[model samples]
Target: MTQTVPQTTAGADDIQEIVERILSAAALPPIVQAGHPALRQRAAEFDGQLSRDQLDRLIGIMRQVMHEAPGVGLAAPQLGIPLQLAVLEDQFDVDPEAAALRNRSPLEFLAILNPRYAPLGTGRASFYEGCLSLNGLQAVVARPESVLLEYLTPDGAAEQREFVGWQARIVQHETDHLNGVLYIDRAQLRSLSSNAEYAAHWAEAGISKAREGLGFDAGPAGISLD
Candidate 1:
């Protein structure tokens, strides 16, 4: 399935009520796990579905949840809201050596509303990815190395942007959440591992050992693990 989510419209008042109800239910909403119906349903797009204050609050809360989870990106479906909204940020906390190896750099915080993306080229890269909702498991998932993204800013201005390397992967991952897809759905089943197993058996070798031992091919792509 593609990450093409159809736009949806809801009265601002109605959306405000919904947001308020959900917020009141939890000061910090829990990340909905993999099997939740909300995670399985396609999210409704944002079309002025929030008043300025409500939108601000929602974005603030989303950012808090994302940061607290220590995740690079998070989508509304992960919060059980089923809305096409997401927040992404990365500090490139890794050492310069690792950052360069991953083609990673710092990213400012961004809230993407009703976002979509297209691969920039045929190039792809594979890496282990874990989700806040899935907790404690990681799997090798291959994704486009670069992507062109279209999204609405918090103020509803439409924008197009390009992201590369690790940032591109983050964009694809969160966007997939809005479309009711998880990384595991596109992962190499043989490469699945618990956090402990990954650290104990594959962390030092990067993905090369996992690929060779697990018998999955990452194909020719961006970052070389050889």
Candidate 2:
């Protein structure tokens, strides 16, 4: 039986408002596009131990930016910070059963710090991928269907976890940002086509299986609050 979590009063619009405020308030530099050298250069250290107040502020800002942009993920560098941090929101309204099969949740967000990733076992999955930085492009990228991650939490506690399916893919993409890498770097030559072309390719190749396999039949999934 699928379990459903109670819906909260929070909505996307509410989150968007917070994001706009953060963009206006933050002294972030403009977003660096896909080919920018900075996107290739490794991000600098976050410098100094993060205070609770500062970590909260960064998290809040990331949440706002992500909401306004309506993206699956966002990174500190996108917000003009050269730090090893990022936020991911995997909360699009999608089929839950498909999500479960694909190892994904409908709407979940994560704040990752100084993350490191490794393949979980073997086997690889190819999926069409896009990025907030690239905006108008999509490509087929091959990645491990599952992975293990180690990272520090916002509170500076160590955490380790295993991820699979779309969730694992999303984590890999975002962790690349922390390391200053973009999906385009790993994009397949033929998959580097336009969005429409890539979508068609993905459909023909059963890439959508990952989405259809994810299960949202269970109630709302829980996110880490720590």
Q: TM-score of every model?
A: 0.88, 0.72
Instruction: Give the per-residue lDDT of model 1 (tens digit) for 1-226.
Output: 3343333343446456668876676578888898976676667788766777877888888899988888888898787676789999998478776677677888899999988899898998888889999999998888889999999998879999999998998998898888777888788878889999998888842589888887887753222111
Global Cα lDDT for candidate 1: 0.81
RMSD of each: 4.8, 12.8
What is the per-residue lDDT of model 2 for residues 15-107, given as tens digits with 9 covering 90 to 100?
334344554664633456776544554555444335566667777777876777767888876764556778888778767665565666653
Instruction: Give the top-scoring candidate (TM-score).
Output: 1
Model 2 spans > 4 angstroms off: 1-30, 47-50, 95-102, 196-226
Model 1 residue 101 distance off true place after TM-score fit, in angstroms: 2.0
Candidate 1 weakest lDDT stretch, 10 residues: 217-226
Q: Cα RMSD for candidate 2?
A: 12.8
